[model samples]
Target: MKQVHTRFPVMETERLQLRKIEVQDAENMLTYLQDPDVMEYYGLPPFVSAEQVLDEIAWYNKIFTQQTGIRWGITLKDEDKIIGSLGFLNWVPMHHRVDIGYELNQEYWGKGIASEALQAVLAYGFETMELERVQALIEPANLASIHLVEKHGFLREGLLRNYEYGNGKFDDLLMYAILKKDFLASSK
Candidate 1:
Protein backbone atom coordinates (compact mmCIF):
# COMPACT_ATOMS: atom_id res chain seq x y z
CA MET A 1 0.00 0.00 0.00
CA LYS A 2 1.06 3.64 -0.44
CA GLN A 3 2.19 5.72 2.50
CA VAL A 4 -0.83 5.99 4.80
CA HIS A 5 -2.30 9.00 6.50
CA THR A 6 -2.44 8.75 10.28
CA ARG A 7 -5.70 10.64 10.60
CA PHE A 8 -8.74 10.83 8.45
CA PRO A 9 -11.97 12.78 8.47
CA VAL A 10 -14.34 11.66 11.21
CA MET A 11 -16.64 8.95 9.91
CA GLU A 12 -20.29 9.19 10.79
CA THR A 13 -22.60 6.25 10.73
CA GLU A 14 -26.30 6.29 11.50
CA ARG A 15 -25.78 6.48 15.25
CA LEU A 16 -22.05 6.67 15.94
CA GLN A 17 -18.97 8.68 15.06
CA LEU A 18 -15.62 6.97 14.55
CA ARG A 19 -12.87 9.42 15.38
CA LYS A 20 -9.38 9.44 16.83
CA ILE A 21 -9.05 9.08 20.59
CA GLU A 22 -8.42 12.43 22.20
CA VAL A 23 -7.40 13.70 25.63
CA GLN A 24 -10.93 14.99 26.16
CA ASP A 25 -12.16 11.43 26.12
CA ALA A 26 -10.11 10.33 29.13
CA GLU A 27 -12.97 10.72 31.58
CA ASN A 28 -15.59 8.99 29.53
CA MET A 29 -13.04 6.40 28.45
CA LEU A 30 -12.54 5.52 32.09
CA THR A 31 -16.24 5.23 32.62
CA TYR A 32 -16.20 2.28 30.23
CA LEU A 33 -12.70 0.85 30.76
CA GLN A 34 -13.13 0.87 34.52
CA ASP A 35 -16.17 -1.31 34.28
CA PRO A 36 -15.26 -4.86 35.35
CA ASP A 37 -17.63 -6.52 32.92
CA VAL A 38 -16.41 -4.39 30.03
CA MET A 39 -12.80 -5.25 30.70
CA GLU A 40 -13.42 -8.93 31.35
CA TYR A 41 -13.07 -10.04 27.74
CA TYR A 42 -10.37 -7.46 27.01
CA GLY A 43 -7.78 -8.93 29.42
CA LEU A 44 -7.96 -5.89 31.70
CA PRO A 45 -8.21 -6.27 35.43
CA PRO A 46 -10.53 -3.87 37.20
CA PHE A 47 -9.11 -0.36 37.00
CA VAL A 48 -8.50 1.16 40.42
CA SER A 49 -7.94 4.74 39.38
CA ALA A 50 -8.98 7.26 36.81
CA GLU A 51 -5.29 8.09 36.48
CA GLN A 52 -4.71 4.60 35.14
CA VAL A 53 -7.33 5.22 32.50
CA LEU A 54 -5.67 8.48 31.54
CA ASP A 55 -2.40 6.64 31.17
CA GLU A 56 -4.12 4.28 28.75
CA ILE A 57 -5.59 7.17 26.80
CA ALA A 58 -2.13 8.74 26.66
CA TRP A 59 -0.75 5.48 25.37
CA TYR A 60 -3.45 5.35 22.73
CA ASN A 61 -2.54 8.87 21.63
CA LYS A 62 1.06 7.76 21.14
CA ILE A 63 -0.09 4.74 19.19
CA PHE A 64 -2.09 7.04 16.95
CA THR A 65 0.92 9.24 16.23
CA GLN A 66 3.13 6.26 15.49
CA GLN A 67 0.68 4.82 13.00
CA THR A 68 0.82 1.49 14.82
CA GLY A 69 -2.92 1.36 14.43
CA ILE A 70 -5.79 3.71 14.94
CA ARG A 71 -7.84 3.56 18.14
CA TRP A 72 -11.19 5.20 17.71
CA GLY A 73 -13.46 6.55 20.41
CA ILE A 74 -17.01 5.54 19.54
CA THR A 75 -19.45 8.26 20.42
CA LEU A 76 -23.15 8.86 20.12
CA LYS A 77 -23.64 11.42 17.35
CA ASP A 78 -26.62 13.23 18.80
CA GLU A 79 -25.55 13.12 22.42
CA ASP A 80 -21.87 13.62 21.48
CA LYS A 81 -20.73 11.35 24.27
CA ILE A 82 -18.25 8.56 24.21
CA ILE A 83 -19.90 5.24 25.03
CA GLY A 84 -17.16 2.81 24.01
CA SER A 85 -13.97 2.29 22.09
CA LEU A 86 -13.17 0.17 19.08
CA GLY A 87 -10.19 0.04 16.76
CA PHE A 88 -7.35 -1.76 15.03
CA LEU A 89 -4.79 -2.94 17.59
CA ASN A 90 -1.98 -4.84 15.86
CA TRP A 91 -1.02 -3.74 12.41
CA VAL A 92 1.44 -5.60 10.23
CA PRO A 93 2.21 -3.63 7.12
CA MET A 94 4.53 -6.16 5.58
CA HIS A 95 2.01 -8.94 6.00
CA HIS A 96 -0.93 -6.80 4.97
CA ARG A 97 -2.87 -7.82 8.07
CA VAL A 98 -4.05 -6.24 11.29
CA ASP A 99 -5.60 -7.46 14.54
CA ILE A 100 -8.97 -6.10 15.62
CA GLY A 101 -10.22 -5.50 19.16
CA TYR A 102 -12.85 -3.46 20.99
CA GLU A 103 -14.77 -2.96 24.25
CA LEU A 104 -18.10 -1.35 25.07
CA ASN A 105 -19.56 -0.18 28.36
CA GLN A 106 -21.82 -2.82 29.93
CA GLU A 107 -24.66 -0.33 30.01
CA TYR A 108 -24.44 -0.17 26.22
CA TRP A 109 -24.45 -3.89 25.60
CA GLY A 110 -26.94 -5.49 23.15
CA LYS A 111 -27.34 -2.18 21.35
CA GLY A 112 -25.21 -2.96 18.25
CA ILE A 113 -22.69 -0.15 18.79
CA ALA A 114 -19.86 -2.63 18.75
CA SER A 115 -21.04 -4.01 15.46
CA GLU A 116 -21.37 -0.57 13.89
CA ALA A 117 -17.90 0.46 14.98
CA LEU A 118 -16.48 -2.86 13.86
CA GLN A 119 -18.03 -2.72 10.44
CA ALA A 120 -16.74 0.79 9.86
CA VAL A 121 -13.21 -0.17 10.88
CA LEU A 122 -13.22 -3.28 8.72
CA ALA A 123 -14.28 -1.23 5.72
CA TYR A 124 -11.61 1.34 6.46
CA GLY A 125 -8.97 -1.34 6.83
CA PHE A 126 -9.71 -3.06 3.56
CA GLU A 127 -10.64 -0.04 1.48
CA THR A 128 -8.59 2.78 2.93
CA MET A 129 -5.64 0.87 4.35
CA GLU A 130 -5.68 -1.45 1.34
CA LEU A 131 -5.14 -4.47 3.53
CA GLU A 132 -5.45 -8.02 2.32
CA ARG A 133 -7.13 -9.18 5.52
CA VAL A 134 -8.16 -8.09 8.96
CA GLN A 135 -8.65 -10.58 11.76
CA ALA A 136 -9.83 -10.53 15.34
CA LEU A 137 -8.29 -12.78 17.99
CA ILE A 138 -11.13 -13.26 20.38
CA GLU A 139 -11.35 -15.57 23.33
CA PRO A 140 -13.85 -18.31 22.56
CA ALA A 141 -15.62 -17.68 25.82
CA ASN A 142 -16.48 -14.22 24.53
CA LEU A 143 -19.41 -15.53 22.61
CA ALA A 144 -20.90 -12.14 21.91
CA SER A 145 -17.72 -10.85 20.26
CA ILE A 146 -17.42 -14.02 18.21
CA HIS A 147 -20.97 -13.64 17.01
CA LEU A 148 -20.43 -9.97 16.30
CA VAL A 149 -17.58 -10.76 13.97
CA GLU A 150 -19.59 -13.57 12.43
CA LYS A 151 -22.45 -11.21 11.77
CA HIS A 152 -20.03 -8.97 9.89
CA GLY A 153 -19.16 -11.89 7.60
CA PHE A 154 -15.80 -12.62 9.17
CA LEU A 155 -15.20 -16.34 8.78
CA ARG A 156 -13.92 -18.49 11.60
CA GLU A 157 -10.52 -19.75 10.58
CA GLY A 158 -9.73 -21.93 13.60
CA LEU A 159 -8.93 -21.98 17.25
CA LEU A 160 -5.43 -20.85 18.13
CA ARG A 161 -4.48 -22.67 21.33
CA ASN A 162 -2.97 -20.71 24.16
CA TYR A 163 -2.81 -17.62 22.06
CA GLU A 164 -3.24 -15.22 24.92
CA TYR A 165 -2.89 -14.99 28.68
CA GLY A 166 -5.96 -13.53 30.28
CA ASN A 167 -7.94 -13.25 33.51
CA GLY A 168 -5.75 -15.91 35.19
CA LYS A 169 -5.01 -18.65 32.72
CA PHE A 170 -3.80 -19.21 29.21
CA ASP A 171 -6.77 -18.82 26.94
CA ASP A 172 -7.40 -20.36 23.57
CA LEU A 173 -8.05 -17.86 20.77
CA LEU A 174 -10.76 -17.95 18.20
CA MET A 175 -9.58 -16.49 14.90
CA TYR A 176 -12.01 -14.79 12.59
CA ALA A 177 -10.76 -13.15 9.42
CA ILE A 178 -12.27 -11.23 6.55
CA LEU A 179 -10.15 -11.09 3.46
CA LYS A 180 -10.62 -8.21 1.04
CA LYS A 181 -12.15 -10.52 -1.50
CA ASP A 182 -14.35 -12.06 1.12
CA PHE A 183 -15.55 -8.70 2.33
CA LEU A 184 -16.33 -7.49 -1.17
CA ALA A 185 -18.05 -10.73 -2.07
CA SER A 186 -20.18 -10.67 1.04
CA SER A 187 -21.20 -7.09 0.34
CA LYS A 188 -22.29 -8.03 -3.15
Candidate 2:
Protein backbone atom coordinates (compact mmCIF):
# COMPACT_ATOMS: atom_id res chain seq x y z
CA MET A 1 0.00 0.00 0.00
CA LYS A 2 3.05 2.25 0.21
CA GLN A 3 3.99 4.35 -2.78
CA VAL A 4 7.40 4.18 -4.42
CA HIS A 5 9.61 7.07 -3.40
CA THR A 6 12.23 9.04 -5.27
CA ARG A 7 14.98 8.16 -2.80
CA PHE A 8 16.52 4.74 -3.24
CA PRO A 9 15.19 2.07 -0.93
CA VAL A 10 17.49 -0.32 0.85
CA MET A 11 16.35 -3.90 0.50
CA GLU A 12 17.67 -6.89 2.38
CA THR A 13 17.34 -10.62 2.00
CA GLU A 14 18.68 -13.50 4.07
CA ARG A 15 22.19 -13.06 2.77
CA LEU A 16 22.29 -10.02 0.52
CA GLN A 17 21.58 -6.34 0.47
CA LEU A 18 20.22 -4.30 -2.42
CA ARG A 19 21.30 -0.68 -2.44
CA LYS A 20 21.48 2.18 -4.86
CA ILE A 21 24.23 2.07 -7.44
CA GLU A 22 26.73 4.87 -6.87
CA VAL A 23 29.89 6.16 -8.51
CA GLN A 24 31.91 4.38 -5.84
CA ASP A 25 30.38 1.13 -7.01
CA ALA A 26 31.91 1.34 -10.46
CA GLU A 27 35.11 -0.37 -9.35
CA ASN A 28 33.19 -3.20 -7.79
CA MET A 29 30.82 -3.50 -10.72
CA LEU A 30 33.67 -3.68 -13.19
CA THR A 31 34.55 -7.06 -11.72
CA TYR A 32 31.52 -8.69 -13.30
CA LEU A 33 30.75 -6.21 -16.08
CA GLN A 34 34.12 -6.91 -17.63
CA ASP A 35 33.94 -10.63 -17.26
CA PRO A 36 33.21 -12.21 -20.62
CA ASP A 37 31.25 -15.06 -19.08
CA VAL A 38 29.16 -12.68 -17.01
CA MET A 39 28.31 -10.29 -19.84
CA GLU A 40 28.06 -12.85 -22.62
CA TYR A 41 24.41 -12.17 -23.25
CA TYR A 42 24.67 -8.39 -22.97
CA GLY A 43 23.79 -6.46 -26.09
CA LEU A 44 27.21 -4.87 -26.25
CA PRO A 45 30.74 -5.94 -25.46
CA PRO A 46 31.83 -6.18 -21.82
CA PHE A 47 32.47 -2.82 -20.18
CA VAL A 48 36.18 -2.15 -20.40
CA SER A 49 36.60 0.62 -17.86
CA ALA A 50 35.29 1.98 -14.59
CA GLU A 51 34.30 5.18 -16.38
CA GLN A 52 31.80 3.24 -18.45
CA VAL A 53 30.28 1.86 -15.28
CA LEU A 54 30.10 5.42 -13.93
CA ASP A 55 28.14 6.40 -17.00
CA GLU A 56 25.85 3.48 -16.39
CA ILE A 57 25.32 4.52 -12.78
CA ALA A 58 24.42 8.00 -14.02
CA TRP A 59 21.84 6.52 -16.34
CA TYR A 60 20.46 4.43 -13.51
CA ASN A 61 20.01 7.53 -11.38
CA LYS A 62 18.47 9.39 -14.31
CA ILE A 63 15.74 6.82 -14.72
CA PHE A 64 15.09 6.62 -10.99
CA THR A 65 14.75 10.40 -10.71
CA GLN A 66 12.45 10.45 -13.71
CA GLN A 67 10.23 7.89 -11.97
CA THR A 68 10.81 5.49 -14.83
CA GLY A 69 12.89 2.78 -13.11
CA ILE A 70 15.26 1.73 -10.33
CA ARG A 71 18.51 -0.19 -10.32
CA TRP A 72 20.06 -1.78 -7.23
CA GLY A 73 23.51 -3.06 -6.61
CA ILE A 74 23.54 -6.57 -5.15
CA THR A 75 26.08 -7.27 -2.46
CA LEU A 76 26.60 -10.11 -0.06
CA LYS A 77 26.34 -9.35 3.62
CA ASP A 78 29.71 -10.90 4.25
CA GLU A 79 31.45 -9.33 1.31
CA ASP A 80 32.14 -5.67 0.75
CA LYS A 81 32.15 -5.90 -3.04
CA ILE A 82 29.14 -5.62 -5.26
CA ILE A 83 28.31 -8.84 -7.08
CA GLY A 84 25.87 -7.45 -9.62
CA SER A 85 22.72 -5.40 -10.27
CA LEU A 86 19.00 -6.05 -10.77
CA GLY A 87 16.24 -3.61 -11.59
CA PHE A 88 13.01 -2.57 -13.25
CA LEU A 89 13.01 -0.50 -16.40
CA ASN A 90 10.50 0.96 -18.84
CA TRP A 91 8.11 1.54 -16.00
CA VAL A 92 4.59 2.61 -16.93
CA PRO A 93 2.65 4.02 -14.02
CA MET A 94 -0.73 4.04 -15.78
CA HIS A 95 -0.33 0.40 -16.65
CA HIS A 96 1.29 -0.42 -13.29
CA ARG A 97 3.94 -2.53 -14.97
CA VAL A 98 7.69 -2.64 -15.36
CA ASP A 99 10.34 -4.74 -17.08
CA ILE A 100 12.87 -6.65 -14.95
CA GLY A 101 16.49 -7.35 -15.69
CA TYR A 102 19.45 -8.66 -13.68
CA GLU A 103 23.00 -9.96 -13.76
CA LEU A 104 25.34 -11.57 -11.21
CA ASN A 105 28.99 -12.38 -10.92
CA GLN A 106 29.84 -15.77 -12.41
CA GLU A 107 31.47 -16.90 -9.21
CA TYR A 108 28.18 -16.57 -7.40
CA TRP A 109 25.96 -18.02 -10.09
CA GLY A 110 24.97 -21.32 -8.47
CA LYS A 111 24.50 -19.99 -4.96
CA GLY A 112 20.97 -18.59 -5.29
CA ILE A 113 22.20 -15.04 -4.71
CA ALA A 114 20.35 -13.84 -7.76
CA SER A 115 17.14 -15.35 -6.48
CA GLU A 116 17.46 -13.67 -3.10
CA ALA A 117 18.01 -10.30 -4.73
CA LEU A 118 15.12 -10.84 -7.14
CA GLN A 119 12.73 -11.87 -4.39
CA ALA A 120 13.36 -8.62 -2.54
CA VAL A 121 12.92 -6.55 -5.67
CA LEU A 122 9.70 -8.33 -6.56
CA ALA A 123 8.30 -7.71 -3.10
CA TYR A 124 9.01 -3.99 -3.37
CA GLY A 125 7.61 -3.77 -6.87
CA PHE A 126 4.36 -5.41 -5.83
CA GLU A 127 3.96 -4.36 -2.23
CA THR A 128 5.53 -0.91 -2.14
CA MET A 129 5.22 0.26 -5.72
CA GLU A 130 1.77 -1.31 -6.08
CA LEU A 131 2.53 -2.54 -9.52
CA GLU A 132 0.00 -4.75 -11.25
CA ARG A 133 2.43 -6.76 -13.37
CA VAL A 134 6.14 -7.37 -13.65
CA GLN A 135 7.66 -8.60 -16.91
CA ALA A 136 10.98 -9.92 -18.14
CA LEU A 137 12.28 -9.88 -21.68
CA ILE A 138 15.10 -12.36 -21.91
CA GLU A 139 17.17 -13.69 -24.74
CA PRO A 140 15.91 -17.06 -25.92
CA ALA A 141 19.40 -18.47 -25.75
CA ASN A 142 19.91 -17.54 -22.11
CA LEU A 143 18.44 -20.68 -20.63
CA ALA A 144 19.74 -19.95 -17.16
CA SER A 145 17.97 -16.61 -17.02
CA ILE A 146 14.86 -18.17 -18.50
CA HIS A 147 14.82 -20.77 -15.77
CA LEU A 148 15.42 -18.14 -13.10
CA VAL A 149 12.27 -16.21 -13.98
CA GLU A 150 10.27 -19.37 -14.40
CA LYS A 151 11.25 -20.48 -10.91
CA HIS A 152 9.82 -17.22 -9.59
CA GLY A 153 6.40 -18.04 -11.16
CA PHE A 154 6.63 -15.92 -14.28
CA LEU A 155 4.64 -17.34 -17.18
CA ARG A 156 6.12 -17.22 -20.62
CA GLU A 157 3.69 -15.16 -22.66
CA GLY A 158 5.45 -15.49 -25.99
CA LEU A 159 8.49 -14.65 -28.00
CA LEU A 160 9.34 -11.42 -29.74
CA ARG A 161 11.16 -12.03 -32.97
CA ASN A 162 13.98 -9.58 -33.56
CA TYR A 163 12.90 -7.89 -30.42
CA GLU A 164 16.34 -6.52 -29.68
CA TYR A 165 18.89 -5.22 -32.10
CA GLY A 166 22.05 -6.08 -30.25
CA ASN A 167 25.48 -7.48 -31.02
CA GLY A 168 25.19 -6.15 -34.53
CA LYS A 169 22.01 -8.07 -35.44
CA PHE A 170 18.47 -8.62 -34.32
CA ASP A 171 17.89 -11.18 -31.59
CA ASP A 172 14.76 -12.94 -30.36
CA LEU A 173 13.49 -12.34 -26.83
CA LEU A 174 11.25 -14.47 -24.64
CA MET A 175 8.66 -12.49 -22.75
CA TYR A 176 7.65 -13.65 -19.28
CA ALA A 177 5.36 -12.02 -16.77
CA ILE A 178 3.66 -12.40 -13.37
CA LEU A 179 0.71 -10.44 -12.06
CA LYS A 180 0.49 -8.99 -8.56
CA LYS A 181 -2.40 -11.22 -7.57
CA ASP A 182 -0.54 -14.34 -8.53
CA PHE A 183 2.60 -13.23 -6.77
CA LEU A 184 0.82 -12.34 -3.56
CA ALA A 185 -1.09 -15.61 -3.59
CA SER A 186 2.05 -17.64 -4.03
CA SER A 187 3.78 -15.85 -1.18
CA LYS A 188 1.05 -16.87 1.20
Candidate 3:
Protein backbone atom coordinates (compact mmCIF):
# COMPACT_ATOMS: atom_id res chain seq x y z
CA MET A 1 0.00 0.00 0.00
CA LYS A 2 1.07 3.58 -0.60
CA GLN A 3 2.29 5.27 2.54
CA VAL A 4 0.16 8.19 3.64
CA HIS A 5 1.72 11.52 4.50
CA THR A 6 1.04 12.99 7.93
CA ARG A 7 -2.34 14.71 8.05
CA PHE A 8 -3.46 17.87 9.78
CA PRO A 9 -6.58 19.50 11.13
CA VAL A 10 -9.11 21.68 9.29
CA MET A 11 -8.09 24.47 6.91
CA GLU A 12 -10.01 27.39 5.49
CA THR A 13 -10.23 29.94 2.69
CA GLU A 14 -11.79 33.35 2.35
CA ARG A 15 -15.13 31.99 1.15
CA LEU A 16 -14.78 28.38 2.28
CA GLN A 17 -14.33 26.54 5.50
CA LEU A 18 -12.68 23.21 4.65
CA ARG A 19 -13.14 20.71 7.38
CA LYS A 20 -12.37 17.04 7.65
CA ILE A 21 -15.12 14.86 6.26
CA GLU A 22 -17.45 13.51 8.86
CA VAL A 23 -20.08 10.80 8.57
CA GLN A 24 -22.68 13.55 8.44
CA ASP A 25 -21.36 15.01 5.21
CA ALA A 26 -22.38 11.90 3.29
CA GLU A 27 -26.02 12.95 3.00
CA ASN A 28 -25.38 16.53 2.02
CA MET A 29 -22.63 15.58 -0.43
CA LEU A 30 -25.14 13.44 -2.27
CA THR A 31 -26.88 16.54 -3.54
CA TYR A 32 -23.66 17.50 -5.28
CA LEU A 33 -23.05 14.03 -6.63
CA GLN A 34 -26.66 13.23 -7.48
CA ASP A 35 -26.76 15.84 -10.18
CA PRO A 36 -25.96 14.16 -13.51
CA ASP A 37 -24.60 17.29 -15.11
CA VAL A 38 -22.33 17.99 -12.14
CA MET A 39 -20.93 14.48 -12.28
CA GLU A 40 -20.77 13.85 -16.03
CA TYR A 41 -17.17 14.89 -16.39
CA TYR A 42 -16.21 13.72 -12.96
CA GLY A 43 -14.94 10.17 -12.66
CA LEU A 44 -18.17 8.95 -11.14
CA PRO A 45 -21.71 8.91 -12.50
CA PRO A 46 -24.81 10.29 -10.85
CA PHE A 47 -24.98 8.63 -7.46
CA VAL A 48 -27.64 5.96 -7.23
CA SER A 49 -27.98 6.01 -3.45
CA ALA A 50 -26.76 7.59 -0.26
CA GLU A 51 -25.00 4.40 0.69
CA GLN A 52 -22.33 5.00 -1.92
CA VAL A 53 -21.62 8.45 -0.52
CA LEU A 54 -21.43 6.98 2.94
CA ASP A 55 -19.00 4.37 1.78
CA GLU A 56 -16.81 7.04 0.24
CA ILE A 57 -16.97 9.18 3.33
CA ALA A 58 -16.03 6.22 5.45
CA TRP A 59 -12.94 5.61 3.39
CA TYR A 60 -12.03 9.28 3.43
CA ASN A 61 -12.35 9.48 7.20
CA LYS A 62 -9.81 6.71 7.51
CA ILE A 63 -7.56 8.30 4.93
CA PHE A 64 -7.69 11.59 6.79
CA THR A 65 -5.99 9.92 9.71
CA GLN A 66 -2.92 9.43 7.61
CA GLN A 67 -0.21 12.05 7.14
CA THR A 68 -1.07 12.02 3.45
CA GLY A 69 -3.48 14.78 2.55
CA ILE A 70 -6.47 13.08 0.99
CA ARG A 71 -9.71 15.04 1.01
CA TRP A 72 -11.84 17.69 2.67
CA GLY A 73 -15.50 18.60 2.66
CA ILE A 74 -15.86 22.10 1.24
CA THR A 75 -18.44 24.25 2.96
CA LEU A 76 -19.35 27.84 3.66
CA LYS A 77 -19.01 29.73 6.96
CA ASP A 78 -22.68 30.72 7.14
CA GLU A 79 -24.19 27.65 5.47
CA ASP A 80 -21.54 25.19 6.68
CA LYS A 81 -23.23 22.52 4.57
CA ILE A 82 -20.84 20.54 2.43
CA ILE A 83 -21.51 21.97 -1.00
CA GLY A 84 -18.34 20.49 -2.52
CA SER A 85 -15.10 18.68 -1.76
CA LEU A 86 -11.40 18.90 -2.68
CA GLY A 87 -7.99 17.47 -1.84
CA PHE A 88 -4.69 15.83 -2.72
CA LEU A 89 -4.26 12.10 -3.27
CA ASN A 90 -1.76 9.63 -4.66
CA TRP A 91 0.83 11.49 -2.68
CA VAL A 92 4.43 10.93 -3.75
CA PRO A 93 6.44 12.79 -1.21
CA MET A 94 9.74 11.56 -2.63
CA HIS A 95 8.97 13.37 -5.85
CA HIS A 96 7.77 16.46 -4.03
CA ARG A 97 4.49 16.34 -5.90
CA VAL A 98 0.93 15.15 -5.42
CA ASP A 99 -2.34 15.00 -7.35
CA ILE A 100 -5.09 17.50 -6.63
CA GLY A 101 -8.81 17.13 -7.32
CA TYR A 102 -12.08 18.79 -6.38
CA GLU A 103 -15.81 18.96 -7.20
CA LEU A 104 -18.61 21.34 -6.26
CA ASN A 105 -22.39 21.44 -6.39
CA GLN A 106 -23.63 22.49 -9.78
CA GLU A 107 -25.58 25.32 -8.17
CA TYR A 108 -22.27 26.82 -7.07
CA TRP A 109 -20.53 26.56 -10.40
CA GLY A 110 -18.80 29.62 -11.93
CA LYS A 111 -18.89 31.33 -8.57
CA GLY A 112 -15.05 31.11 -8.18
CA ILE A 113 -15.25 29.09 -4.97
CA ALA A 114 -13.14 26.40 -6.56
CA SER A 115 -10.31 28.81 -7.22
CA GLU A 116 -10.36 30.13 -3.68
CA ALA A 117 -10.30 26.64 -2.23
CA LEU A 118 -7.46 25.63 -4.53
CA GLN A 119 -5.30 28.59 -3.61
CA ALA A 120 -5.57 27.83 0.06
CA VAL A 121 -4.59 24.22 -0.49
CA LEU A 122 -1.69 25.20 -2.69
CA ALA A 123 -0.42 27.51 -0.01
CA TYR A 124 -0.76 24.77 2.54
CA GLY A 125 1.11 22.32 0.37
CA PHE A 126 3.98 24.66 -0.21
CA GLU A 127 4.28 26.12 3.28
CA THR A 128 3.11 23.44 5.68
CA MET A 129 3.77 20.31 3.66
CA GLU A 130 7.07 21.78 2.41
CA LEU A 131 6.27 20.57 -1.06
CA GLU A 132 8.26 21.72 -4.05
CA ARG A 133 5.41 21.22 -6.49
CA VAL A 134 1.75 20.24 -6.81
CA GLN A 135 -0.10 19.04 -9.86
CA ALA A 136 -3.66 18.79 -11.07
CA LEU A 137 -4.56 16.22 -13.69
CA ILE A 138 -7.64 17.71 -15.29
CA GLU A 139 -9.71 16.32 -18.11
CA PRO A 140 -8.76 18.25 -21.25
CA ALA A 141 -12.34 19.29 -21.85
CA ASN A 142 -12.69 20.51 -18.30
CA LEU A 143 -12.10 24.13 -19.17
CA ALA A 144 -13.49 25.26 -15.85
CA SER A 145 -10.91 23.30 -13.91
CA ILE A 146 -8.19 24.29 -16.32
CA HIS A 147 -9.00 27.92 -15.72
CA LEU A 148 -9.08 27.41 -11.98
CA VAL A 149 -5.52 26.06 -11.91
CA GLU A 150 -4.35 28.69 -14.35
CA LYS A 151 -5.84 31.48 -12.31
CA HIS A 152 -3.87 30.15 -9.35
CA GLY A 153 -0.61 30.30 -11.37
CA PHE A 154 -0.30 26.65 -12.29
CA LEU A 155 1.45 26.08 -15.61
CA ARG A 156 0.35 23.70 -18.31
CA GLU A 157 2.76 20.80 -18.26
CA GLY A 158 1.28 18.54 -20.93
CA LEU A 159 -1.48 16.12 -21.72
CA LEU A 160 -1.60 12.46 -20.90
CA ARG A 161 -3.96 10.79 -23.35
CA ASN A 162 -6.09 7.99 -21.98
CA TYR A 163 -4.77 9.00 -18.60
CA GLU A 164 -7.75 7.64 -16.74
CA TYR A 165 -10.56 5.27 -17.61
CA GLY A 166 -13.32 7.33 -16.16
CA ASN A 167 -16.92 8.33 -16.92
CA GLY A 168 -17.21 5.36 -19.29
CA LYS A 169 -14.71 6.61 -21.83
CA PHE A 170 -11.07 7.29 -22.63
CA ASP A 171 -10.26 10.54 -20.84
CA ASP A 172 -7.26 12.69 -21.67
CA LEU A 173 -5.79 14.52 -18.72
CA LEU A 174 -4.21 17.93 -18.97
CA MET A 175 -1.43 18.34 -16.44
CA TYR A 176 -1.21 21.69 -14.65
CA ALA A 177 1.44 22.32 -12.07
CA ILE A 178 2.96 24.99 -9.81
CA LEU A 179 6.49 24.88 -8.50
CA LYS A 180 7.33 26.28 -5.11
CA LYS A 181 9.37 29.05 -6.64
CA ASP A 182 6.64 29.85 -9.12
CA PHE A 183 4.06 30.00 -6.41
CA LEU A 184 6.20 32.32 -4.29
CA ALA A 185 7.12 34.40 -7.32
CA SER A 186 3.52 35.16 -8.15
CA SER A 187 2.73 36.01 -4.56
CA LYS A 188 5.46 38.66 -4.47
Global lDDT of model 2: 0.89
Q: Whose TM-score is greatest here?
A: 2
Q: For model 1, what is the alpha-carbon lDDT of residue 56? A: 80
Of 1 and 2, the candidate ranking higher by lDDT: 2
List, in order, the clash count of every candidate structure.
0, 0, 4
Quote the positional error of residue 20 for candidate 1 in Å. Answer: 1.7
Candidate numbers, best TM-score first, in rank order: 2, 1, 3
- State candidate 3's TM-score: 0.91
Q: What is the C-alpha lDDT of each candidate?
A: 0.82, 0.89, 0.82
Report the CA-based lDDT of candidate 1 relative to the real structure: 0.82
For lDDT, the strongest prediction is 2
User: What ordering of candidates by lDDT runs from best to worst?
Assistant: 2, 1, 3
* Runs in model 1 lying further than 4 Å from the true structure: none
Where does candidate 3 clash, by residue pair? Answer: 5-67, 5-68, 6-67, 7-67
Model 1 Cα lDDT, one tens digit per residue, 7-58? 5447888889988776777778788787888888888687777788888888
Kindly list the per-residue Cα lDDT of model 3 for residues 1-108, writing each as its tens digit: 244345445887777898887777788999888998788778888898989999888777665666455787889878879999888876667777888889999899
Per residue, candidate 2 scores C-alpha lDDT tens digits across 1-188 of 22478578998889998998888888989989999888878777899998889898999998888888999999888876788999999998888999999999898998999988888999999988889999999888899999899999899999999998876899889999999998988788
| Model 2: lDDT of residue 87 | 94
Candidate 3 global lDDT: 0.82
Q: Assess every candidate by TM-score.
A: 0.93, 0.96, 0.91
